[model samples]
Structures are given as structure tokens and as C-alpha cells.
Target: MSARTSAPSWRPANSSGRSLWLAIAGLSPPAIGDSHTGLRLMGDVLSLARRRPFTSAVILLIVAVYVVEIAQSRPAFWLEGKGDLPDIAALGVVWTPAIGDGEWWRLITASSLHAGLLHIALNCYALVVIGGAAEARFRWWRTAVIFLVAAVGGNIAAAAIQPGAASLGASGGVMGLAGAVVVGAVWSGEGLARSQWVIGAIIATVAFGFINPGISNAAHIGGLIAGGAVSLPLGLTARLRRTQRPAPAPKTQARGTAPGRATATGMNPRQVEFQRRIDAAMAKARAEREEDARRASSGE
Candidate 1:
């Protein structure tokens, strides 16, 4: 019998096309065919973390909290769908009644919580993309301010609009970052081509929220508005600073001119006219004094 040949056991199951696409997108390190691909990817992440320390810190904190969440609940809770409400509440998910009862910190804390592994995974990915861009462009402090403000604003809106519903996740803050990017681009006069993809993504996300039940559209809208509002003044200030011109250096005084007077060379029409009037008046006074002196001499 002829010897049979088989495919290598170490090869990945995914099609070459899919693997190639994933590799191109930088989404699958294993597909790159290099044993050190993971190490290279890790190094790249470390480099990005160094450049975006605040974004990295926020992402790390969210991940750490998620780890605690996993420990407190069944494996299925994270892997499949929604977790136990009581467990989630204990872990700081936002509930309107709790906030009403003076557990207001939940508004801020709930943003750091997530509904499931998928939820947190999507959020963290968005955070890495949006937060990193924001930090790179707007500085870490401004990015932090935008994230925190949007989180609180989103929770407040949810509490007001859907009092009976419980909410969790960082979608609001992510949407807020999207809004800030859009508004920031407009104010800074950046090319629309650069931001059109962001705009399309925002529209698609909001549309998806509307289609999907249990999604917090109110919080999303609130966060978008709050983020845009915050970014407006910042963008305006930055644009103003960029466009501002220093006042022309004060014209140097002519060598023979008085300290307060400017040279005619650089003077405007109005200034030149004023200087001419002053000179004419001084000449008239001198002529009058000379005439008086001549008359007095004749009288003597």
C-alpha cells in the first residue's frame, strides 16, 4: 500500500483567507506565522502603554475589576450573558433606586463594571482605540476628564429616564469619546476624510442600540452631548491659540521724536494726520513768539 500523507497537526484550523485578513488587521498574532509574534505584539502593546499611560492605567483597572467580578460569580455568568443582579449590584452596577437612596457613587463606579465578558471585551477594545486617540491628541488629563464626566452624565440620564432598569458598562463613555472626536475635528479644522469613519461608526452604533433591547440609548445620548459640550470650549480655546498672532512690536520712537510719539514711517493715516496737526500748531506758536520779539526790539 502507498504511504498516506496528512496535513501538519500544528497548523491552525481557520482558512488561509480569514487568517490573512486577521493578520492584516493585527487582530490575530498567531496567524502571522512567526513563533515570536506574540512577544512582538506584547512589546508593541508595552510601547503603546508607555506613550499612553493614562489610557493604559484605565484599561488595566477595568480589567482588574472584571477579574474580581469573575471570582464572585459562576463561570457561565461572564461567558454567556447577564450575571446575577445581586452579584452585579454588589460589584457596583448602577441602579436608580440605589442612587436615589444615596449610593450616588454607583453612578461613577458602574461605568467601570460590565455585564459580561463580551461586553467588557468590546468596551475595552473601544477604550483602547478611542481613549488612546484622545490621549494622543487631547492630552491624558483632558481624556480622563471626558471619560469621567461622560460616565457620570450617562448614569444620571439613565437613572432619570429608566428608573426601573439597571445599567452597566462603558458604552456611554465610549460614545462620549466618539462625540468629542467628531466635535474636536470640526473645531480644529481637521480633514473630514479622517473623521468620516468615526461618524459612520457612531451612527451604526446608535442604530444598533435602538434595535437591540436592553440597551441604554438615553445614557448614550446624554454622554454624547456632555462630551461634545466639554470638548467645544477646549477645541475653541485651542483653535484660538493656534490662530492668535502676537501684537506687532511697538514701533520704536524716532531718534529726535518725543518718547510717546511714533515715527511717521510706520504710522497709520490717522496718526500721520495727527502728527501733522501737532507740528503745524508748534510752528505757528514759534512764528508768533518771533514776531513779538522783533516788535519789542523795534520799540526799544
Candidate 2:
């Protein structure tokens, strides 16, 4: 029937595939509440961007570069890949010989360049999930340092491994975020679930490289190691301090008093008043006892 066919038609052909990739990228909806509401999803995305300003800015820059490239008739799609990249080489892409010739800025700039929209989209999506989480955990400056180090490290490694070819894209930085998350979670004593998602993302990214011949596996590996290396000591120190710290002892109450009851010269006004009343009652009782003793001694 039309209804049966309509349901299948409404689904994107690669819906399942995209979902698997998203899960591997740590983009799955949080477990607490699942919703299909567009407005709520948009609001959450905005909130994440606000929390991670640097990450958001990086994503925006990549998108802007891609748009300009497209408008200028560069390789505009996945199918027409890598043809116009050389045209922008002087502008961003990393070439080893160029670095040797003193174009060191390429190490950082190349990471913001992409071969196509598909590449940029994947990296941005990964950034939103992984980078946002990293920023929230490590703060903006640390996250920025990690990303920059990982990106430059990845490019340098790629250049060394394949000096003749040029490398581009935020893949290295994205992988770095993954690596940082994995090691940071483990070192901070975060539970298995936290580490597993990041590990899964790394595996998924590596798998993508094997499937695509042009993808640079070297950059991914280099960035990952660099990120983990940078975050490990920081995470471990924090965990060590937490473990070594002493626990605070509980406050003890006066003997034979009910919970919430006050004592004399206590911190609270109510307790001070209660203590005064108890002191007066004790004094009167002591005086009466003395009078009784005196009477007995006098045989009155």
C-alpha cells in the first residue's frame, strides 16, 4: 500500500549509515531524554556553541572557507575532489618542502582547509560533539592548545610521511579531540562509558581512512597521540590530588540530646536560650537540695 511505501521513502537512503557514524563520533542523543523536536534540538546546539566558543569559531571559519572555495569554482563537491586544492596551496595546504623553505604557518592553516563540503561537515560535526565536551572539561585555553598542537603535529607527521603530497582538513584536530577525551576521562577516573565513546570514535575514524585511499591515516594517528600526550599528565595530577585528599569528619552532638536540639553556648540563638533555661533549672534544683540537707541536720 501507499502508506507502507511512504514510510520507507521518507527515510534517507543513508540514514542507518549516518546514524552509525554519528554514534561512533559521540553524537548520539543523551540517554536521559530523547526527543524529535526541532526547536529543542536547535536550542541545545546553540547552548553547546555558547559553552565552547573557540570550537564554534573554528567550525564557522571552516564553513566560510568552503563557501568561498565553492563560489570561486573550486572542487565544490565530493565527486570533484582535490582538483582545485593546489590552487589554494599557497593560501593554506601544507607541503613539506614549503615548510622547509620557511612557510611554517602552513602547519596551522592547513587544518582549517578542506577538500570538500562532506569533509568539512564531518569534521565540524565531530568538533561540535568532541570539541565541545573537551572545552567543557579542560576550559577554552587548554582545549585550544590541544587542538593547535594536535593539528600542527599531525601536519608535520603527514609531511614527513608523504613529503610529495599536500595535506588538508580538520580531521587531525578532530581526532585530537577524540584522543584527549579518551585519555582525560581515564586519567580523571571517569567511568568506562566516557572512555568507550571516545575510543569508539577513534576506531571509527581510523576505519574511515582504510576505506578511503586518499585519506591520511598518518595525520589522524599523530594528532591522537599528541592530544593524549598533552592531556595525560594534567588529568593524572588532578586525579592524584583527588585521591590523596582527606574526607571531612561529621559534627558530633551533645550526649543525651535529641537530633536538632540545641546546647549551651552553641552557635545558634535558639541553642543559647535553651542552655540558659537548663542552667537556671539546675541552679534552683541544687539550692532546694541544700535546704533539705540543712533541715535534716537541724532535726526540723
Top of the candidates by lDDT: 2
* Candidate 1 RMSD to the correct structure: 15.4
Please give the lDDT score at residue 14 for candidate 1.
7
User: How well is each residue in 158-263 modelled by candidate 2, as lDDT tens digits?
Assistant: 7787676677778788778778888787666666586676777788777766665467777888888888788776566656776899997756765444554543
Clash list (residue pairs), candidate 1: none
lDDT of 1 by residue, 1-24 (tens): 101112111110100011122222
lDDT score, residue 245, model 2? 96
For each candidate in turn, give its C-alpha RMSD to the true structure in angstroms. 15.4, 10.4
- Candidate 1 has a TM-score of 0.69
Q: Per-candidate TM vs. native? A: 0.69, 0.67
- Residue 204, candidate 1: how far off, in angstroms? 1.1
Residue ranges of candidate 1 with Cα displaced over 4 Å: 1-33, 240-300
